[model samples]
Target: RTRMGQNQTSIKKEKLDDLGNKTHFTQKQLKELNKQFRKESPSGTISQDEFNEAMNLMGVVDPFLQNLVFKVFDKSKTGTITFSDFVNGLSIMTKGTQEEKLKFAFEMYDLDESGYISKEEMTKILESFYKLIGPSDDNPLATFSGKKYDAPQQLVDEIFEQMDVSGDGKISLAEYQEGAIKNPDIIQGLKLFSES
Candidate 1:
């Protein structure tokens, strides 16, 4: 049994090494990268130097509507973003008939159909968003601007709590619509689509 255990551990270690090679970043390297990122964007506000630094850090890549995304997520005047902020940004970016989109989002987030989105409901929504946006094994987002990824779970919870203004544990269609309109990306997308 001891030998078998050792063999299993070795196999797992080998697999981890293989993944590291494929991803081209060791755990320490990843930590350093994240540290560097935080050092640069600690307050979330983009300085010109930071902007240029990010360009260099992330490498040349296609713009994935990042400026619009940053504008939407930088809520609370905080320099750093949480997961909730990211999803709220996505909610705003989603396009459709305003009423329809709001209704759908509210329904999806309102797990209990209590006509409001609770923290639990919002977590699920954020998870869904991560699944939608996270780097897939087959294809990944361009490595520009550090690749816009899904929000962290804790951040998602915070965002849900903040958005539920009435404390009713749910967000109504009106609230959702209002939030959506506040998002510049969604508004721009809607406007461009309308014009086209």
Candidate 2:
């Protein structure tokens, strides 16, 4: 009886330790997790295949949602989004309510706060967002999605290029904020993404 009780206590102690470790996420870690979750979907340059894959991954197969997403990406009204258009659409989709989302957009894209968003600023924001959400050394994408793929670097670069308007290699906070506000779906998506 004494030996059995000791074993039970030891097991309980181990379980408690495991729970404690799992519950503690630093701010940086949480930010990274958010970023990784975002990247699971194609952001700036989403091929039709990639978009479809993202829909499947997110379990959002509703026709209405699909149409809405398609519309968002159809920036040229050309009925099909090119790689650059797809990326821009994804960035737009990540936006939220004008008032609330603008704060985050400004902070993220405004490196100089010159009342304008530059291409470099946009690229920096995208890179940071990708880094924060993309798989890290400690936490790989497979761990979260239970699937494997090539490294996310290519996708990240593609997104940055798509968002960097003016061909100047940057995007200003103002630009981001304006884009975000224009798309209500993106704002809604942002809320849902953050809550999760």
Candidate 3:
């Protein structure tokens, strides 16, 4: 059993090399990445608890986004993220093909995994950004009349108009691709490619 596990890790290392070549990360970089991953995930996979720790290390305060990131890396739909999947998932956002990056972003925003990023989810994500930047009076999440908001309806409307091509309240994967293509800043700001 131990030998089988070792072989799997070795096979994963070979795949990681292929991934690194495509992403321009040399063997040394891949080695360092694996080292760091092992520091946090010595078993070659990271469970939800370990993922939370990693998120905390990244100074990620929002639980929602943290979980979304975990989901992205757990491509096998398993509860934990293996080292190979972790490296591959990181590449998807940082230097993978355009389609891979867009697919990742789509999953990132689709908090519910409902196959679409609903207007409510969009509003929540936008509100989270405002919170991170220190909300001002104009920010949707700011208390209005000494009370929290039920929803940021206006912000959702504006976002829908910009990206919801089918007049649906949610953004589908197709709509997300078109919107990202239309707004280069979305790609650049999100670091969807190494060039950005």
Which candidate achieves the best lDDT against the true structure?
3
TM-score preference between candidates 1 and 2, better one = 1
Off by over 4 Å in 1: 1-96, 135-150, 167-169, 185-196
In order of lDDT, best first, we have: 3, 2, 1
Q: At residue 83, what lDDT does model 3 achieve?
A: 71
Model 3 lDDT at residue 76: 91
Better of 1 and 3 by TM-score: 3
lDDT of 3 by residue, 28-70 (tens): 8788888898886778888988888876776666777777778
TM per candidate comes to 0.35, 0.30, 0.74
Question: What are the runs in model 2 whose C-alpha is more than 4 Å off?
Answer: 1-97, 135-174, 184-196
**Model 1: per-residue lDDT, tens digit, 53-146?**
4534544122322332343344554654543343333334343456544554455456565766666666664454444345443222211122
Looking at model 1, report the run of 10 residues with the lowest lDDT sum. 137-146
Q: Which pairs in model 3 have colliding backbones?
A: none
* lDDT of the structure predicted as candidate 3: 0.72
Candidate 2 residue lDDT tens string, 26-139 = 435434543554575344344556666676577555434444456555557666565435434434335333454455445434555565655455445444444445545332
- For each candidate, the alpha-carbon lDDT, in order, equals 0.47, 0.47, 0.72
- Comparing 2 with 3 on lDDT, the higher-scoring candidate is 3
